[model samples]
Target: MAERSDFSFLDEAEATCRLAMDPAATGIDLCLILERDALLPAVESIDAAGFFIEDVAVLDVAEGYQARYHFRRFDTKGRIELRVTAPHDDPHIPSIANIFQGAEWHERESMDFYGVTFDGNPNPARLLLPEDATIKPLEKDEKSRKSYLDLMPEFTIVECAEGHPIEELAAKRQAEREEAERKAAEEAKKAEEEAKKAAEEEAAKQSEEAGEAG
Candidate 1:
């Protein structure tokens, strides 16, 4: 069997989301808990790292609506899940259709079934339900709904440490990304200069050979 991909990188990606749980109990490789505002950046990072969306699912829980995005890489043997929750009264999560075109259909299907609104979805029309349908057949009654945390006991929900709010984490992450970009640019420039020098040296050596031949 192929070795499982290491997800220690997610610990460094705390800017995208809180690295909440070990997915061993959850049957996945990694589970990331994201706030609504961090969803796009997290997904963007996932996409940049070569993972593709496997599916987008919504759960109607007592805490509210839980949006779960499953991601997997073609070259890897592990799965990563992104979880975000919206209040029951406000079941709105940002749509990732712009980042992953395939998510448009999945979001529409969730809208039809669970009444979860995927904000910014290009086409939010019903996918399987009738155009005039208003009732979301999959929405459970309050009594029937389960607590989000209860369903996912593996998640470690802890209060943010003093002076390290989500906003601060996000800002730090941005700075780190900018620094990485700057270093990459510098490296590329250095490589280009070295290549030019090598080319010039080759040309000088060829000219010397030609002069000797003459």
Candidate 2:
């Protein structure tokens, strides 16, 4: 387990994750945004650092304003995430992808529906909304907003290990363990066969001597 750091610096957002720094910064505060499967361990990792969870916050949308969850995190040094929400009518949040390069997709997503803009993002292209698709699907009324999280299937939270992707590491470990076990079983079988052959030879020699004496 990694040791926790002092996270008192980030209480402004409701549920922000103080992402551990990449090569770019010594440290940074990331405002997290949640889609469907983007929570899980990443959420817990941020929460373990002592961030607050705010179920409500205000967003500055170009068309108008809206209310949504706004969480905050702070005092972290590496890959971290902050989750925020906006209203069904114009869902939008400030993009921190510039501060944390990984925020590009999240900012793009915010733009897809809420039409929010990241102040200085290089590529705020469509994310969830596909190219040339004529549907702002997430734009919602009160009833539709209730099941936004549930409706989205691609919400699996993936940890961004700048040095190592968790998926590859896990597969490697599993393969090593299996290989070791297979070798051990083969050695044991070979030893057992040698012992059995030796015992059979000894029994045959003794019987031949007894028959000659009789």
Candidate 1, residue 61: Cα displacement in angstroms equals 0.4
Relative to the true structure, candidate 2 has a C-alpha RMSD (angstroms) of: 14.0
Q: Each prediction's TM-score against the native?
A: 0.67, 0.33
| Alpha carbon lDDT of each predicted model | 0.79, 0.47
Report how far off residue 51 is in candidate 2 (Å). Answer: 13
Q: Candidate 2 at 9: error in angstroms?
A: 2.9
lDDT of 1 by residue, 37-120 (tens): 878987888888788899998999887888999988777678888888899888899999999999999999999998889999
Best by lDDT: 1
lDDT of the structure predicted as candidate 2? 0.47
Candidate 2 residue-wise lDDT, 79-124, digit = tens: 3334344444544445444444555665566566556555466786
Instruction: Point to the candidate with the largest TM-score.
Output: 1
- lDDT measured at residue 127 in model 1 versus the true structure, 0 to 100: 96
